[model samples]
Target chain A: MNITSVPFLFLFLPICLLFYYLIPNKKSLVLQNVFLLLVSLFFYAWGEPIRIFYLCILIVVNWLLGCFVDGKKGTKLGKWIVFIAVLINVGSLFVFKYLDFTLENIGFILGQELPLLGFTLPLGLSFFCFQAISYVVDIYRGKVKSTKNLLNASLYLSIFFKMTQGPIVQYNQFESQLISRKTTWTGFCDGFWRFAIGLAKKMLIASNIGYVVTDIFATDTASLPVVSAWLGCFAYMIQIFFDFAGYSDMAIGLGKMFGFEIPENFNYPYISTSVTGYWQRWHITLGAWFRDYMFYPLTLGPAIRMRKFLAKKKVNKNVAKFIQNLFVTGCIWFTTGIWHGATWNYVVWGLINGAFIIWELYKKPLKNKKLDSALGWLYTIAVAFFTKAIVCTPDMGSAFSYFGSMFGLNGNSLVSDTTLFYFREYWIFIVIGTLACFPIYTKIKEKLVNNSNNSKKVKTILYGIETVALLIVFIISIAYSFKNGYTAFIYQKF
Target chain B: MQEKIKEILGELLIGVDLSSKTLADDGYIDSLIVVNLVSELDLEFDIEIPFDALVNENFNSVEAIEALVKSLQK
Candidate 1:
């Protein structure tokens, strides 16, 4: 069930917390882990009862394989086990996620209607499988030791907070906490506060903007005005960032409540001056995962090997390295795009991102020392404004048309009543969400909380005010949730 | 090796001189620069840095890069 839902907020979470705290065993956390596992299973089952079976089987298989893969690392058996794990994990993902895309393409090519397996993708199957693969690969690499404890492995793979909408925490990151973490009052308070903020962000900000996006997208783009087109796309940027980032905040907050220190996902991504910087900030964990698992292995492994071979053949060193990097870059970004969805739009979006990043990579040394950061920020924003439309549109042609409409090149008016209405209604959300995208709030919070000159009484009053503000935000968010609006998370499909 | 590393870094860096003993001390190389440096060193030194070898200390300075390359060459 969604964390924002009434049942989850009022029933599941409270009951889960009650059982969790009451179930004793202060020192040994075996009982705690099991309790979490059972509750998490119930959570998963509540959403996708069919998917939970697959999830359980996958977890068991990985744990079993992990038993041998750790000690025998680099040996034939260890290497093979790791290979099998990757194949099974990634292979299942490919079949479940991409099989339809492949079949549809083949059908067009062959001039025949192919029978398609209309599969309802198991909830979080891609994420579940990816995490499992990450675990097994870590074991083989000896980054983390394999464990006999099924509960430990299970908990790592199926932690309730991050299971669906993920920052994709690595295997070694919080596994220690899963074993023996000391939950503190401070941690609980921090988690609650973070959860409240994320709830407000999602419920109040994302949900409100989402309505504007849906209305704009639902209107035929052929007649959509230039200003309306731009506004709609920008609204999407706000909707998606707050949506995914809010989910990440909740995940991290819940992890904190469990005394697990999950990593932050977003760090003012809009402030990034470059596409590379954007990737580093936006969906930080996903970028890291691809870099570590896919990009590095591809680059340092096969791509480097090929480049070296080319260099041996008397190819210019710089040229060889560039070619290899470009080739590897293509693969990494293409895979990244596919990971988002089984759509050509996503693939092109991914490619555009990759192309921009590679362009920046080459442009690094050539950057003028005197170039203002505002110019870079403007460039980044313009790029996002154009490219993000592709993610919102159904296909590449529509994305291109939306761009044309934004420029008034698609026979659309410069100003429209719809655009003005949207601006009037959503000005507050747009203002708040856009401002929040910067580091302004974070900076102010840091200065206030970290002001050492403030007396204890002053600090206490500030803290009291902050706590009340957070509660009010939480209460308002709950009201919005109960207001029966469109509330599905954007990233749940991915 | 130090001189050669300085030369390579000089080319990679935008405006800063590589005279400082430590690159990080002067805020010369961010994480992106380090990745580029890894590729440059990989090609120049002809050493494939295992993913595990890409660490902060190894990429911290001119000397550290030189040392990392020498060790990898062995």
Candidate 2:
């Protein structure tokens, strides 16, 4: 059921689009939504036949909870209801995603062998659960009114475009679109162009470079040559960005084709001058989610309380602020890490990122533009390299060994045949991948539009060129997709 | 109230311009600064800025912040 598969591209999407647009009454929102809902359910069930039932029950439950929580704003009952809703959503996520990991650790601590309950995780459980929680919370906070229609609720949480991996659209942001939307020929063309670009990014770039990354990591980290280690890490850095961002582009493109606008996720994250800036651009929706839902709440609630208590005790003002910042940053990162997976490496990765971000906060390296831009970028990339290494490695031991090789700390050669071979094979993809990390195409498009000066002729020519380029990209991407069988998006696991 | 907010923002952000209309959107103030500003405003005005009022629009300018604080105080 990978979206890049031939069946999906040729059969499922074409059929779905045909039926959707073929509906006689384009103005009938209910009919369109009902059609979309059924299709979305079918998409889910097609992938996870048994887990579709779990998703349905959760959807109905959250819909009912949203109903109950609405109009009870500022009351204790409303607060409790929202809390229970969050509990149900997060509890389910915990049971499916984290229970086994938690139990194993507990067993280790208690010196008893505990039997593991092997429950298969449903696809997109993490994503939909977050959306469900946001729906109830937004209702309770009076940000968005609860939908009385179960269809709208189901569609909101289980929309096929965003269900699997997301830009994590907030309920308030998506509620309006669900009610009223317009599908135009122009919009569909634009969506198709975007989807074509995403497909190219994935098939032409990410998948091509990914083979080298996988092969390098499969080698013994301790014996990995320094050049090979660096090469693998560098390739991985590109692979992950294109893989996730490309998927996001496809999802966004699909949304546009259906008259929905999914939020932008990645915004040239690799060009960020600081770690803090990097987070702002990378996986933007997730960062915003953490900021709005977790960071702000913790800051306004416990961090503020702790600060006040420290102030009352006559603690130094700066010291109190520092401690508060540390607490907030620590909590956010710890959760952010574990949210990626039920692995200690992910936790470590999160904490490492958090530490670097906190350092930037205090240092304010770019505040006065004091640090040179080139140096700042280098520093940020260096941090990213180590963090990406941590993410790709299986465990701490492997990560350290990889790092050791990367720095020539391990008794490993500087250059190896593997490194030379990878460079020889993937140099073009590597070069393209690196350049594609920036907004080069966007800049070019902007330049064309700016220079066109409202001339219809120039506009027409630009459009023609864009269309042709997109067609070429699509054809090549289709070829690559066929050559490389179904490759799952990296973020799909998260 | 506007002057008070400007003063607090000035103290926290050092070289940032407080008169800009899109402080948050323009990246003049990040989340850390926003957290500190919220805490400061809460203590200064003795008003709890509800989470719903914590959107970017309310914090994107000194005037907007003043308005949010005034409403919360009421």
Candidate 3:
């Protein structure tokens, strides 16, 4: 269910929170995990019932394999067994997420029409499968102890907070917090505030931006005025940030309310001055995951050789270093972009980011502070949003064509008078959506709410006002929902 | 070594004189600045820094980074 849906907002969350908190202190980890497992399963099954059985079977088999692999750690045979298990999990993910694209490519090459299996992808299959593989891999590496308790393992694999999209928590990072965290009144209030803010971000900002962007993209490129195309692209840029970031905020907030501390998924990525900076801030956990797991390992050979070379000679460091970074960074971005989806668009998106990073790597140094601050930001945002057009479009030709339209090079009306038509329709949303991705407002609110010098009376009055404002925001979001079908979270399809 | 770092930062970050800025400040070479600097440093100095080093001593300050670079040079 969409996080903004009235049924989810009013009924499911409240009831879940109540029961989760009300569990008596006597329940074992087994029971608590089982409770979480059941809730998570129900949450997934509510949207896609037929997929639930397969999802459960995957969870159980993977959990057992993880245990088996962990038990075998340190032996050569154990290493082989774990490797095979890891391959199985990732292979399943690849099959589910990429099968159709793979088959179509094969069909194109062979000049034979293979019947499409038309497999319905299970929700969050990519994320959960990765989580499973990481858990086993970590165990095999002795980075974490294998949990004997199957239910605990199951909960780690299937938690609702990350099941849809993820910060891709490491098994130990999650379980460590899970075992020790306490539910408190203050914590609950904090979580509730976070949830409400995230809900507002999604419903008020993302939805409105989605409405206009969807509308503009729906129009044929030839008919779309240049100004309208640019405006639509701009709106899409803001829409995606808020939509994905909002989902992350809600996921983190939900994790908090459950007394779990999921990783923060974003920083203020838009303000970054470099493509490298953008990756650090955007989908931070994912970047870190790739850096730790993929980039470092792949570059180890060259990196080691480079280190030894540097030790021996006072040779030119910049050129050698740039080459090393370019290679590693190129692979990181290439894999990162493809990791988002199986499409050529995602591949291009990744390469574009990779290219930009590589360009910055070897280009003349940028030192002008005034230009660096404003122009740098504009350039980074433009590059990101422009390439995001690739991420949003289905194919390369359409994206390049739309990108051409952005420059008014496609012979469309350079200044579509109706450009203001979209501005009038989506400007408020664009403004709010852009601002919502930053933490400044939330930080400001925290200072107001937590200032010790404020009188209790003043605090109560401010809290009351804030609550009322949030309620209204919630209502407006609901009212908008009353207008359309539930817009699925984009990441859910992955 | 300090001069080398200055040249590198000046080249990578573009506008700032690393000679003037106190490398003591975290902003001296922010994360992106650090990544660029290290990529250059790795090539120039031929020292491979593990990713975690960026979080630890490598980017903390000029002295810290210099010390790490010198050690790696060995």
CAPRI-style docking class of model 1 based on DockQ? acceptable
Instruction: List the candidate 2 regions with Cα displacement exceeding 4 Å.
Output: A25-27, A364-371, A444-459, B1-4
Question: Which candidate number has the best lDDT?
Answer: 2
lDDT tens per residue, model 1, A370-400: 4646777788888887887888888888888
Local lDDT at A102 for model 2? 91
Model 2 collision count: 0
Model 3 misplaced regions, further than 4 Å? A26-29, A69-82, A110-114, A301-323, A363-365, A414-421, A437-465, A482-485, B1-74
* Superposed Cα deviation of residue A417, candidate 1 (Å): 2.8
List the candidate numbers ranked by TM-score, top first: 2, 1, 3
Q: Chain B TM per candidate, please?
A: 0.78, 0.93, 0.68
Flag clash pairs in model 2: none
Flag the better candidate by TM-score, 1 or 3. Answer: 1
- State TM-scores per candidate: 0.94, 0.95, 0.84
Off by over 4 Å in 1: A364-370, A445-459, B16-36, B46-48
- Please tell me which model should have the higher TM-score, number 2 or number 3: 2
Candidate 3 per-residue lDDT over residues A198-301, each given as its tens digit: 77777778877887888778776656777877777788778777777878888888888887888888888988877777877888877767755566555554
> Model 2 Cα displacement at B29 (Å)?
2.1
Error of 3 at A485 (Å): 4.4
